[model samples]
Target: MQQVKAVVARAKGQPVEVTTINVPDPGPGEAVVKIQACGVCHTDLHYREGGINADFPFLLGHEASGVVEAVGDDVTSVAPGDFVVLNWRAVCGQCRACERGEPQYCFATHNATQKMTLAEGDDAGTELSPALGIGAFAEKTLVAAGQCTKVDPSARPAAVGLLGCGVMAGIGAAINTGAVGRGRSVAVIGCGGVGVAAIAGSALAGASPIIAVDIDAGKLETAKALGATHTVDSSTTDPVEAIKEICAQTYAGAEGADVVIEAVGRPETWKQAFYARDLAGTVVLVGVPTPDMTVPELPLIDVFGRGGALKSSWYGDCLPSRDFPMLVDLYQQGRLDLDAFVTEEIGIDDVEAAFAKMHDGGVLRSVVIL
Candidate 1:
């Protein structure tokens, strides 16, 4: 067993604590990773607030980049010393989703079979539920071998690690799910990390007249740097009307954009996305919603009248094997400004503080560097 420092949420609605935990040796299909850096994602906060589930003391951290330190004898996909990013979707090839050739929607993902427990405390023997199958806010973590996606070692850990979750979801929303292309008019609502990343993805795909909508001017400014052609302060302006007016310039007579991405998980914003797109346009919802939240009732005829796709993007429908390395290379070449996502580099002890900053919108991403 290996003793490591990890962040844990001991109870619902409580702050996370950094404590010592026990990590077991790799078993069949498992590996141990020495975490280099991990991004503080909103999902981690959700897990702590009991928004995910009631499993506590939960180990909270997922968007991470690390180096493989050991591997089980049966693991052939990755070995020790490989630089990698941890992904929650470790596809089980036998699942129906994989059998049908869409591993991206794999119904069964892999996780460590053995549990990691508290090292020394009243809860010393308690098994901790790792958030999103990866408790990465630690010095080292144990995970399924397939969870490790090998990438170029030269890539900066703090920036590349964001690709493991939120960034990937945003980028995927525009590229994979929305299928944004050259000269396509696109609008992204709610310009947080995910929203800004969506703008970046749209730019990378060569989308023109990219409109970014958000209440915060700071985030909108960041979006512009990332490649947004215009910004809308949604708090004062009607985003739907703004999007339609801006996109109309591209279409000459059209009323809306070819694609509208909703990165904020709220029923109201969803309604905006639904009405903000041009006829036969796509609407991709990448933001997560709470169970209590329900879609506001809309006419069935309107749904049929839309005549386009309305889809939810799960982790951007990304296949890590195809995306991680390529995005990293883009970042390395200075084409993609992944580094701009990192607003600050914090230590493990400051995760709670980072969480506060995220809640207040004071930073884009506060990475925990080990």
Candidate 2:
């Protein structure tokens, strides 16, 4: 075991602490990663707030990139010195989903069998519940070997680390779940990190008339720079009508965009997405809704009449092993502006400050450099 400095949320709605934790050496099928960079994601904040569960003293942070420091005897997919992105979905190849060659939907994803524990304080020796099974806001962390996806070493850790979560979720929402492609008209509701990533993905896929919907004008401007062909200030304009009007102008008689991504995870925005898609078009919900929030009521006849799919995206339905390397290459080629997603780089101790800045419209991501 080794002691390392890490950020921990000891209780619900309490300030996070930077303290020492004990990370066990890799066991069978596990690996130890020396974290280089980790992005501060909203989910980490959710975990800290007890919004995810009652798992207190949670080791927070998940979106991360690192170098393999050690591996168990059975580990082979990655090795010491390899640059990698950490992922929560470490697929079990024996699962039914993997058996059918759809490991992205693997039913038995896993984490390290061993636990990291609090090394000091009144809570000493208490095992921590890692956020999304990847407690990466630390100098080092232990995870299942499969959680480490090797990528190009030259890629910037601060930029590519985001692929471990939000950026990948957004891109995958469009490219994987929504099946957006060339000539498809796409509209994304919400201009947060994930929403803008959807716009970037749609642009990467050659989607036309990419409409960005947001209440914040600054976020909308960022969306346009990322690939949104048009912008809708939902605070001032009706997004559904604006998206439909834009798509109709490009594709004659079109009622709305071919694909509408609901990234806000709110009832109102989801309703807008539901009604803002063309006939038989898709509605992909990538945003996470709280447990108390129920699906908005709509007519059963509308569901039957829509003739399109309403899907919830789980981690963008991404297979990290396949997608991570490809995305890194794209970033290296300058085709994907992964760097733009990183708003600032901060020390591990500044996590709470970074969390405070999350509501700032100008900040897309605050990355922690270990």
Work out the TM-score per prediction.
0.99, 0.99
- Tell me how far the alpha carbon of residue 89 in candidate 2 is from the true structure, in angstroms, after superposition: 1.1
- Residues 173-259, model 1: lDDT tens digits: 999999999979999998999999999999999998899999999999999999999999999999999999998877787778899
Candidate 1: residue 154 lDDT (0-100):
92
lDDT of each: 0.93, 0.95
As a whole number from 0 to 100, the lDDT of residue 28 in candidate 2 is: 98
lDDT of 1: 0.93
What is the C-alpha lDDT profile of model 2 across 292-339, one tens digit per residue? 888899999988898889999999999999999999999999999999
Q: CA lDDT of 323 in candidate 2?
A: 94
Give the root-mean-square deviation of each candidate in angstroms.
0.8, 0.7
Q: Compared to the true structure, candidate 2 yields what TM-score?
A: 0.99
lDDT of 1 at 220: 93
**Index of the highest-lDDT prediction:** 2
